[model samples]
Target: MSRIAFTPTRVAVLGAAVLLTAGAAGVAVASGEDVTHPGKRIGTQDAAHPAPAAKDAAAAKAKPREAAALTGSAKLFRKTTEDITFTFDAHLAARHNADPSKATGTFKFVHLEKPGGKGGWATGRIDCLLTGGKVASATGIITKTNIKEMNGSRVGFSVHDQGKKDRLGYSWAAVGGPDGTKKLTKCNSAAPFEQVKKGTGDFHVQPWKLPYPDPR
Candidate 1:
């Protein structure tokens, strides 16, 4: 019998032929193996079952409730039909709820005699703040005032944010305040009566019931 010599070239040709046969059989060829331990596959975890894609960060976050509220500062500048200009400026720190407790901030109300250049003002600290929708109400204890009657009184007012022109209602202008009386309304306001002539600012109402504290 004649002996056949299998050289390195023949060995290489046989290996290529074996690979082609394995590929035809739909066999998964290992691209990499453990370097320390020869013949051990690197990725045994099912390639078909790939790790799930990372969850979308925004979609994974919980959505806020429909009743979630906000709190912040607000201001309004308006003029009445009687040629009296009123300005309200407040820096409120109320919470997301309508409760009067823990409401801390400052409030100021100023009025200018339109034709005449005379003016009076009242300034104080906020005691109460309530809001619902675009309307809001705020009250403050009068700490200082140029107007004698307003001294030691708590002022309250309501605001309606109507885009370009806002509506405002003052405590004294609500009921015309009684004549020569020390009794002043506190934490009470009327519906929006006077439209703003020119102003800038906004209020975000908290979640609450309708008929938002109109004590007029």
Candidate 2:
């Protein structure tokens, strides 16, 4: 019996065949394009690319909602004839000396002139009760006027407190307008409140709520 020795050419051929088979298998796995399985493809379904419009729509949905428009009645009052002032009590004093105390004091929205040269005017008085008091008293014709957005309206006005001079400030948006069912919404002061002069001791009454009607 003759023994046959393996030649380098034969060894190279065998190695090449093994490598070709392995390379083909590796490419199929890496490409992830299995024609046999139509459902399978490159990358992943869950990680699929998003359309430009779809991305934009998603961003729009995430954005904050636009605020409601002001009421017709609220649109009437465009000016004030007198100076508007906000009195602060101990609570307000502690908050920033300018913060109108939800605790005690009075917020008077007085002499609010009508819009469109109507010449009609109104007033509002919000009475702050003692600490822990429920439903403080409010009065005056302006009281009926919506200073907030809904029942309230956001109006640009000035604050004439002691510490802060006449500085422009805006009231919170009320729910309904003056004619709306939800009347007299709360109007919290924004900004410039921090600039108000700090007060101490018992609550004090200050002459605020001056109005200057807008010229028609």
Candidate 3:
């Protein structure tokens, strides 16, 4: 057997050829374009690391917020008759971030006595829009008037249906003064009716100390 002699130049050439072939194969595998599978389709490999889920984007667009609750009581007194006091209690709820002057809820009046001894408790629903914590317009009913007719013909009158025209109803508007007062223009007028806060209860919650007992 004839012995072959090793040369540096020959060895370098051979090494370079091998490196080129290996580099080409590596490129083919990386790019998924191997010459051996020329006709066959090759699926591209995904990234080394997967991208994170986009849950934050979905969380950003949330549902609308709920309305807020406002519960409080006010002393409704008339400027003309300050001595004759009437306790006005309100249990109202407001929409989200709504103006405090605008609220809708229940209102109760206790000991609303007239100078002629014709007075009674009034319980009704109030839909009031206010301006600067002053009443803009308040419309409600005098559900029951414990006062009797002057002729003593009827002991008391009860509002059977709120929708009925015959039912006693009242409407009020703010009378712009230092005191938060409103003027009753419908169903027994009382001018310069002041509203003073007594206390506050939970917001957006109802049925708190309403439908009070007869004070007579």
Candidate 4:
């Protein structure tokens, strides 16, 4: 056997080759791909360390997404300086420019002008609904009320959902113009006003890609 000489030039060349191989491996790790195996990714799911696909699927099934609709009840008001209270259940599809026939719900409003005194009360049926993002606009017709003039008149409501501290507003405050004045039109609601001091219920607001409900 011939003896191999350990020359400095040969040692340097070997070191450079090792460095090149290491650089290639670093590039593969940074790219997040397995160059040696096409169509195979290097991540939580690998050949030797297979991912738990069944477990992931089960978790997704357990926490299903909620359908986009407003179906629940809420008691709104601060009960202090702003003593007007509203309690109602709204069940309607978030349809853009939907007709009054497509909505169904009821609402009761009370205003306590004096502390611990009998206040005026009004009840109505929801006739129209419109929703976008986390906001819902609704309208109703007053069927019964202690205040004579309010009976038979239409009312508007706007809701801004924020978990348990959601905000709400009515047409008298949120809407303006020909519909808000002398005659409060149906299905017209502007931006929400920070009026609700207390809130309870669900408002699964969803975008309805259509025009506002017809005011006719």
Candidate 5:
């Protein structure tokens, strides 16, 4: 994990998937169907893309090992609930000795939730998972404010795709929060992005939220 001090003028910047999981993917019967989101019957390819994308082959061989390495790396965890907050990681060797009541560990959402015209984002949640020490799967809906930007203190999901030499198609977005109201507000979304392979990726963010869905 590398951190560059952020300044007013010189702020240094560092740094997909879908409901469609593996095994759920299928082949299209007719032409003009979406090979990406199969069976759903969106569209199809004019040509039969039988040749396995070289990108997928490479990712198949590499992602697992990369995930393992990330799982073993030490990470920081902080919980926010109300006025009480607790932060821990390789950076902090000392356990913060503060009045638990004063420091909260949940998120407070303000200026983050922007409802999508009619279809409100609902039925979403986030649960970060880690092993050995480092953050492996940030498995949950990361609120816009809680998300770690490219220049954030934390490193992005290089743990998932080791073959990714460029940051083009390697970014992800958040889901939802404690309340169902504020859905996934994407931060630093790398849109119009394509996967190098057929797999899911994790979304990293602040371990905790601060009074999310802030009453405005």
Candidate 6:
């Protein structure tokens, strides 16, 4: 048996590379965005697995609570905004599921940003919490990850600004399931994130933003 050699001419190389990337179905990887890990431990942990009925009830109760106090731009963007397809460094500081304790990790996303001039904006998606509610993943666009799981495992994140000013904003993942009902719990119902400005735009290379084939 002979192994096939893979070589290509430069002309269609870029096009072929794109096609190959597209064919790889969004298989995820770690991101490197946040440089000096920021943020505080704002998560909790739990050993008991609450029933779906209870979880739903908790989500219902927590929704209003989060809304009532709205901290960052998460609230406004969550409704009127949609994630743009781009690359960015996403910093994450997670906590325990049973106790919602603080943990960290670097994540990469085919990030999505809200439409319109985001005063400078960025958006990213991650698997975050696992089914057992034990693992929380944070994949970034490029570079390396600074992800530190609740168990103390850590990864670095690499990211860059696409020349947009809005500082890298942060939000919380409320619930993500098989159903389309997955929602991102805003870090601040009022301002989920601080809108970055133009002189503050950023971007990266390694973890390129996935192409989200949808209308703006």
Best by lDDT: 4
Better of 1 and 6 by TM-score: 1
* Model 5 lDDT at residue 66: 20
Better of 3 and 4 by lDDT: 4
TM-score of each: 0.50, 0.23, 0.28, 0.52, 0.17, 0.17
lDDT of the candidates, in the order given: 0.56, 0.33, 0.35, 0.64, 0.26, 0.29
Candidate 6 local Cα displacement, residue 206, angstroms: 16
| Clash count of each predicted structure | 0, 34, 2, 0, 35, 77
Expressed as tens digits, the lDDT of each residue in 158-197 for candidate 3 is 1111111111112222322112122332212223333332
Query: What does candidate 2 score on TM?
Result: 0.23
Over the full model, what C-alpha lDDT does candidate 1 score relative to the true structure? 0.56
For model 5, residues 80-127, the per-residue Cα lDDT tens digits are 122211111211111221111222112111221222222111111222
lDDT by residue (156-190, candidate 1, tens digit) is: 76777666566777676735641223354445677
Model 6 Cα lDDT, one tens digit per residue, 6-69: 5666547978889877554333212222222333221222348654568999888865211010
Give RMSD (Å) of candidate 3 vs. truth. Answer: 29.1
Order the numbered candidates by lDDT, best leading: 4, 1, 3, 2, 6, 5
Model 1 stretches astray by more than 4 angstroms: 1-98, 174-186, 199-216
Count backbone overlaps in model 5.
35
lDDT winner between 1 and 3, please give it.
1
- Looking at candidate 2, the ten consecutive residues that score lowest on lDDT are 67-76
lDDT of 1 at 78: 33
